[model samples]
Target: MDPATLIGIALAFIIVVVVNVMEGGNPMAMILIPPMLLVFGGTLVICLAGGTMGDAKLAMQGMVKAFTSPAPSAAQLVPELVTLADKARREGLLALEDYVADLDDPFLVKALTMAIDGTDPEELRDILEAEVHAKKAETKQAAKFWTAAGGYAPTIGIVGTVMGLIHVLEQLAQPEKLGHLIAGAFVATLWGVLSANALFLPLGARITRLGELEVAQMELVIEGVGALQAGSNPRLVAQRLRSLLPASQREEEAA
Candidate 1:
C-alpha cells in the first residue's frame, strides 16, 4: 500500500500537537468529545444530505483508494505496448491473441483482444475512449463527495463553536471559570478547520490526482492499441506512447 496519505495525515496532527505544546497549551484539552462529534459527525451527515447513497459508497471507496492504491504508471506500459506492436508487426494482429491470456492489465487485454477479433479501428477507438470517459466520470463523482465534505466541515465547525459560545454565555455568573469555558468553546472551530484542511480536502485532492493518473494510463493504452491495429512500427509506437508521459517518468524509462 502507498503510505503517502497515512504519513501526511500523521505528520499534520503531530505538527499541530507540537505547536500547541510550544504555545504552552495542553494538547489533550483540544481532544474534547463534544466538539469532535459535532465537527466530524455533523460534516458527515451534511455531506450525505448533499449527495446520494451511491456517492457516499463511492467516496468511501475513493478514500480507501487514496490511502492504499499506488499511482498508475503509464511509462511502464510503454515497453509492453511496444512489444505488442513489434509482435503484431511481425506475425500480424492475429498473433497478439497469443499474448492476451498472460497479460495482467484488463484494459490492455481488452483493447488487444478487440483488435485481434478484427474490430474496426474507428469502432475500437470509440469504445475504448467511451470506457475512459465513464471511468473519469465515476472518479469525478467520488472526488466530489470529499470536496463537498471539506467545504461543509469548516461551516459545521463554526456552528459548533457558536453553540459552545452560547453555553459559555450562560455561565456568565461564574466569572472565574470564563476563560476555561471560552477556550473549550473554540475547540469545535478548531476541529472543524483542522479536519477540513488536514484530512478531508487533502483526500479529495488526492483522489482527483489518482484518477487523472489512471485516466492518463488508459488513454495511453488506447493510443497504443490504435497504433497496433494500424500496423505501426514498434519504435514509432514506443515514441508516441513515451510522448504522453511526464518528463520525470520518461527520464526514468531512459535510465
Candidate 2:
C-alpha cells in the first residue's frame, strides 16, 4: 500500500468526523453509510447497467494495481540495468536469451529478447514504444472513466437534492417533517462534494501516475537493453538511465 495516500486519507477523515461530531451535528450525520450508498453504490450500478462494466472493472483494477505494486524507486533501476548491461557485454548477445527466461517483467523480457535476437534497433524501439503507448492509452481510458463519474456526480447530487426537495414540499401541509426533510436533501450535495475530492479525483490521478511510472521504467529497460545490444558501455547505460530519474532522487544519492 502507498503509506502516504492511505494514511493521509484515514487521518483526514478521522479529523473531519471528530470535529463535525464535536460541533454538535448528529453523530450519525457523520455516518458514511447512506451517502456512500447513494454516491458510490448507486453510481456503480448505474454505470454497470449502462454497459460500461469494462471501464468500471478497469477502475477497480487500477486500485488493485496501485495497492499491490511497490513502484521501483527512481534510481533503483540503475544498478540492475547496469548489471544486466555488463552481462550482455561480457557474454555474447545470445547469452541474454538465458537470462530472459528468468525475467519476471514481461516488458523487460520482451525488450531484451528483441535486442538479443538482432532485430533492427528501430523496429525494436517501435514495437516496445507502441506497447508503452497502448498501455498509456488504457490508463487514460480508466482514469477518464472515473473522472467522468466525478463530473457526473455533482449533477446527480443536485438532482438527488431536487428529488428530496420535492419530497419535502409534499410535506408542506405538515410543518413537523420540514427540518428532517431539508437535512436529508442537503445530504446529497454533501455527498457530491466529498466524494469528488476525497475519492474520485485522487484515485484517478494516482492510477494515471502509476501507469506513467510503469511505462517509463519499461522504456528505460528498452533504452538500456538497446544500448547494451549496440555495444554501449555499461557505465554509459547507467549514466543514460540516471538522466530519466527525478531530480530529488538524484540529489539524494549525490548526497
**Who wins the lDDT comparison?**
1
Candidate 1 lDDT, 121-203, residue by residue in tens: 99999999999999999999999988888898889989988998898899999999889989998998999899999999999
Task: TM-score each candidate.
Answer: 0.96, 0.89
Question: Going through the candidates in order, what is the number of backbone clashes in each?
Answer: 0, 0
Per-model lDDT: 0.92, 0.75
Off by over 4 Å in 1: none
Clashing pairs in 2: none
Error of 2 at 230 (Å): 0.5
Worst 10 residues of 2 by lDDT: 27-36
Candidate 2, after superposition: displacement of residue 179 in Å?
1.3
| Cα RMSD, model 1 | 1.2
